[model samples]
Target: MSTIQFTFAVFLLMTCSSRVHSQICEAGWFGSKCQFQCHCTSPCHSITGQCQGKSTCLKGWFGNACQYRDLAHVSSCNIVLNPRQPFSSWVTDRNDSTCNEDVTLESVALSWSTSVPFTWMRLTLNESVILRSLRVSFTSKTSSNATCIDTKLYLINNKTVDIRCKVIVDTTSVIIEGQGVKSLCSLYINGGRNVALKQNSAQTSTYTSPTVAASASKAVDGNTLGLLSSNTCMRTQSSDTCPNWNVTFDQSQVLTAIHIYNTNDAFPVCSGRCGLQLNKFSLESFNSSGTVFRYQDHSTTFTSLYEVTVAEMASGIPVNGLRLGLNRTNPILMMCEVEAYGECVPGSWGLECKKICADRCSSQCHVETGSCPVCNDFDDRSSCHTGCATGYFGYDCSQPCSQNCQNRECNSTTGLCFSCVDGYLGPDCPENVTENIEDHLLILITGLGVGLGVSCAVIASLLIVIIYLIGRGKQPLKESKPSPDYIQRDSIGTGTMDSHGYQIYVTPVRPYQNVSNTYIKVIGDAEVIQPPDTYINVTTKANDEHDDC
Candidate 1:
């Protein structure tokens, strides 16, 4: 109980403190004294320094340590169907919602015979795996002969056996295959159907048909041969009974090689007199330098035709005599085979080979004339070139012309000039009338002359009437005279007059007189005399001696 005991107790205490400190600091360590590795709580992880909840991963991150992953990235998985090759492998298994990545499977080879139905391999995914979507490429091998066959797809899950089923060709029905060991399965068929398994045992499995309908036709004829149609060739005649379609290549089209497939027979048709018919076939070729070689009605035949070498048809061509076919009309009656052979004429190469010839002339020759066609003339008489003039427009170039090309001919093609109409000649119709100015002036002068002549004649007639009236004046008859002595007053006024005691007076006039005149006379003793106002006066008096006294 002395120094040794005290030291031992101190050592134990220090060891416990250090262990507790380590547990609190280190993320991977846990427990009261940091003695055991701790399991992470919600959002707190041992691997990732940060945590939010239990077993949850963030976007663009997965697993421990918050490591970046491509789980959330958008992706496209494309599967292409190759007509040359066929595949019988599991295409994809990406139907589970948990599996967000896209998966695709495609069949490269087309099946020729429906008698031997094509079997698509089963696709299986682990029960724990999650998928988002699936895509597939299923190309038909049917040509003019063989028919297409229906294919079935099946999916299995170990966990959910009750929902696992086989998808039928019709896609409307699903057969329960029973759950065995796996669970959570999905199936997708290209150009066929889809089948999905449900989690509940009481629920039924659902079937979904393909979004795109598959072609329901055959691939080959009775001879099992598949005929390849040329994109540039024209069909001369087509027989409904025969499985093959006859196409004629343009005589001006450069002959490359051809591709022929025999669906019924696997053997190649290269060793026969059977090839493309070059009778009356013509072509034009273009070289790498763009030089062109035109050949008319040149004939060619092909002797060697094989499967592997037929791809040479797309290569450069001098393709005069390339042909590959069977002696019979149906070379591909038994098995589908392909034959492609041709060579461009000298100087012809690349995609430009066919376009060069088409630029100069069309594949079909002119009917009746049988001549190579040229661009139609640009004159007004030709319909092809009958367009708007430079300044004029409409069908016949008859319209009110614009001001841009006044008095000028409009280029019929562009309609950019101003041209005058026929009757109304001017820079732009009536705008500029320089040519007719003199004529208009002459018309005005003539009108003025006619007006002056009419005026003079009227004046002359008026003068003649005045002279006749003066000459015919004063042709009077005999007249009687008024008595001189009797005085007569036309009007009376309101004034009085007294002379020599003889007085005459009148009342004031009610209405003023417009005009009045007075005459006065004086008579005295034995004499009668006129008064000083004899012209006209307001008074008149008679002078008598006796009346004056």
Candidate 2:
């Protein structure tokens, strides 16, 4: 063979080998190969390979000579036909650049209605496969009253879709009016089931259905219904019979489960089954006889033997009453939902009566606890000094003292005062001293003064006696004047005489002798005296004798 022919042959062989290796599957073979199977039934292009016929197109391989398959490319088949309408809009992640290119499918448009306020939308996949996520853009005119817009993604029949709805204004706002949609696979209406309606705030009726009536021919249960029962007599109808079969419970029982079922498959409506008429069904309990618990005013459409509990029941003693009656005026009854069991406890009627009595007494008597201490006969300030007023004493200062106290009043709490009785002194009325305190003090002062005076007198008397005794014990002072018969003599030769009868003498100087300078002489019948140099001489004799010197 020529050299060129040889090279061409080699290249041709290599190309054929590569093409064969790249093919998704060989003829008559199946399963994963270099490319995915398009379920085509015809031949495909050999070079720059593209399939022309529909059958070939279905069989063709488009990626790197069918070495790789991209599932993301499957979105190319989703074509949004009508893209420009007020209520609907189209969305695309990429620009439309390959409209005429047979090899490239790069973009897809999402078509949806903007007028319907729905939170989510779904689309079914071409094949039965699951989709994980989807992207969406909004194009709806915002409502003035609407606060927010929210979008959600849904997988329907294994395809991803978008949904949009208005966000709730507040948490209290009711959303999802009817029973929630059957499954996640279903499309949401207006994005969701939330419907805006005025909340009912009026007080409900107190009517209740008879227990017997409530237990009567339910499409679901044939047995008599018993909820909560107490020993007390059940509430009675006007006929005075215990409302048979009716049950009542406390608020805590509101959330209990109730079982109900319907034989009919037809859904109840507002007029027939969805209206407020079913709310008339009553619950009754003997423990709270005559007291109606609640009156329903809403409609419910449940047909299955289901269970539900009211959410408003509280957690204390059951104050609920139940009865059974129809509000045919509203004409609504389709057995869609029925309640059989609930979590409500029976109440004690006797206890309620006792409580009422206690409350009434507490309000009327206004009596406080604790007794007032007894009052003392005398003024005592210990017990009721601050709590009670004078002259009043009792459990609550509501009573007066029996005996009248003298100059003393009773305290309200202790029936005692701080003052003593009249004509009495000291803390208690111990003494009846007529003297005033001041007068008594004065008397005491007088007694003290008298004691002092007596003490002074005794001292003076003792001094006088002591002086007299001392004088008697000692010699008396010499008489100031000598008797007239006495005589006086002087050493200096001088003499004197007493006035009555005495003689005086004067002598020459004498050694060591006391002498008088002057002397008095009397001539009466008295004796005479003479003075001598060493001796004075004087003599007196009988009538015949004469004195010699």
Say which candidate scores most in TM-score: 1
Candidate 1 lDDT tens digits, 1-549: 899999999999999987656456344432233222222234343322445554443332322232212111112223223221143222222333332122232222223222111122233444521111122222223222211122111112321111111111112111111121123233322221000001011101111224311111121111123332211111121121122222222222233223333221111332443234322222222323322322232235442222222111222222222212112232222112222222123232211123222322232222111222221112242123445534454223444345534465543422333445443433234444444555666766665565555556656655675566557773331232323321121111112213322232333213211111110000012222222211121122212221221
Per-candidate alpha-carbon RMSD to the true structure: 52.6, 58.9
Q: Against the unseen true structure, what C-alpha lDDT does each candidate score?
A: 0.27, 0.28
lDDT of 2 by residue, 318-338 (tens): 334333433333332323223
Model 2 lDDT on a 0 to 1 scale:
0.28
Please list the residue runs of candidate 1 whose C-alpha ends up more than 4 Å from where it truly belongs after superposition.
1-245, 250-432, 474-549
- C-alpha lDDT (0 to 100) for residue 80 of candidate 1: 26
Q: Summing lDDT over every window of 10 consecutive residues in candidate 2, give the lowest-scoring window.
A: 193-202
Lowest lDDT sum, 10 consecutive residues, model 1, at: 192-201
